[model samples]
Target: MKTQVVIIGAGPAGLLLGQLLYRAGIDNIILERQSGDYVLGRIRAGVLEQVTMDLLHQAGVDTRAHDEGLPHEGIELLFKDARHRIDLHGLTGGKQVTVYGQTEVTRDLMAARAAEGLTTIYTAAPVSLHDFDTAKPTVRYQKDGATHEIACDFIAGCDGYHGISRASVPGDALHLYEKVYPFGWLGVLADVPPVSHELIYANTSRGFALCSMRSEHRSRYYLQVASDQKVENWSDESFWNELRLRLDPEACERLVTGPSLEKSIAPLRSFVAEPMRFGSLFLAGDAAHIVPPTGAKGLNLATADVGFLSRALEIHYREGSQSALDRYSELCLRRVWKAERFSWWFTSLMHRFPENGEFGQKIQEAELDYLVNSRAASTSLAENYVGLPLESF
Candidate 1:
């Protein structure tokens, strides 16, 4: 089979890219190692930056998002047993974030692709990229006890951190930078109303806790735990009890507990691979970088990457120029590093670091005091939180 581009993975990044290119009249095929149900089953962060929402609109898949996604104008920061609100909308010129699950975004993209009769081959395993360094690139995969090869002009590596797209490149050609945090986030999804209308980020003596949601009636909460923490160690009652201890008295009084629909512990890490482009192969989303969920940048960063990639490809096809394609990494890395810094800074400020001891706690408290009181500092936080504007291609 032959197509203009071959996209690996059927996650939001891959699916969104396919939709964008398809709208541009670019022929692309998406290959996924897992079934469609498996992709939607993976629970992820729900906070959507305005830039991500704009990209969904550009891809023409924001109908359900606009109808069901909850928009928040601010977030509360808890410290010293008190809560302070950061006016995200006011501080950032009326910019706001939407609480929409990543799964729902993927589902919307998948539905649009199906309606348009786009090609997405699920359960296409053991995929490999060939000749990406040359003018012609090809992707091969195994399905139904047979090997199929797709010849394409370019390949998109959206298969995530462990997929074959990045692995296909020579190790020496890619420079990897990574920092594994000392703790992980024990997250729970429950069908209960959130304590607060807006999200609350808490930094308490116990640990860091986040009260987020997928919708008005569904809550997603997290607690910082040791890196080696096991999900099975904490029961539903214990999780709720521990969460209440970390919250302010008012929040505790309003908190509602219920059976957890999903529970997992995810380690935090900041990782980036320099030069997102390798000849005709390009990496987007988790394949290119990862940020701790502290700032809710993972999915947003992916959306930005593909937005850049799709524009570059469109320019290549329409104007017959390679300038945008050549500069893809430079443009993406600039924004990626900024987000990485914010995630790292936010994580450091909120989590209890035994290594940092009392000094760290005092410093964090002082910074929180300044961040909530100083307009300049608050504006900076709001600007970054809403997402830095995408650079022009």
Candidate 2:
């Protein structure tokens, strides 16, 4: 089969990119190694930066997001037995984040693709890229135990961190930077009203905790745990008890607890692969970078990467120009590095580091104190949290 673009992932990045391309009269197909059900089943963060919401609207998939997604004007930072609210909307020129789940975003994109008859091949396994460095690029994969090949003008490697896209790049040609944190987040999703209207990020002598939500009725909470901690060791009661100990007295009073709908421990890490583009193959989303979830930048970064990638491809096909494509990596990395710095900084401020010792903890406390007390520092945090402006291609 032959197409203008072959996308090697059906995650939000690939699906959203496909929607954008299809609307532009560009031919593209998405290949996924997993079933659609499996993709939807994965739980993820819900906070959406303004740029992400804008792109979703651009793709004609924001009806549900705007209608159902909660708009948070601020986030609460808890420390020293008190809660400090950072007014994100007030600080960022009336910009606010929407609490829309990544799962819902994927669902919306998938539905749009199906409604428009766009092609997405689920269960396409053993995918491989060939000759991406040359003028002609091809994608090979296995479908129902049968090998198939697709010749394409361009390949979007949106297949994510563990997918074949990034791994296929020759080691000598790729430069990698990574830092794994000493802790993990033990997260729980429950069917209950959220503890607060807006998200709360807390730093306690015990550890770090975050109170977030998918909606008014579905709450998502996380507690920092040892990286080697086993989920099986913490029962629902124990999780709730530990969470309460870290929260402020008022929050703990109003906090609701219930049987967890889902529970898991995810290790924290910051990873970035320099030069997101490799010839005709361009990596987007987790294939190119990853951020600690403290700042909720993972999905947002992926959204931005594809927004740039889609526009670049659109200009190439419509105006017969390669200017945007040529500048894709440079433009993307500028934003990527900024996000990496923010996530790293935010994580260090909120989480406990055994190696940091007492002096490190004191420094973290001082930084938080300054961030909440200083208007400039608060504004800086708000701007980064809501996301910086997108670069026009």
TM-score of each: 0.99, 0.99
Lowest lDDT sum, 10 consecutive residues, model 2, at 352-361
Give lDDT: candidate 2, residue 207.
Answer: 94
User: What range of 10 consecutive residues in model 1 has the weakest lDDT sum?
Assistant: 354-363
Model 2: how large is the Cα RMSD against the reference?
Answer: 0.8
Q: List the residue pairs that clash in candidate 2.
A: none
lDDT of 1 by residue, 1-393 (tens): 999999999999999999999999899999999999999999999889999999999999999999999999999999999999999999999999999999999999999999999999999998989999998999999999999999999999999999998889899999999999999999999999999999999998889999999988999999999998899999999999999999999999999999999999999999999889999999999999999999999999999999999999999999999999999999999999999999999999999999888888999999999999999999999999988999997
lDDT of 2 at 269: 92
Compute the lDDT of residue 193 as modeled in candidate 2.
Answer: 94
Top candidate when judged by TM-score against the true structure:
1
Model 2 agreement with the true structure over 163-262: per-residue lDDT tens digits:
9999989998899999999889999999989999999999988999999999999999999999999999999999999999999999999999999999
Deviation of model 1 at 353, angstroms: 0.4
TM-score of model 2 relative to the true fold?
Answer: 0.99
lDDT of every model, 2 decimals: 0.96, 0.94
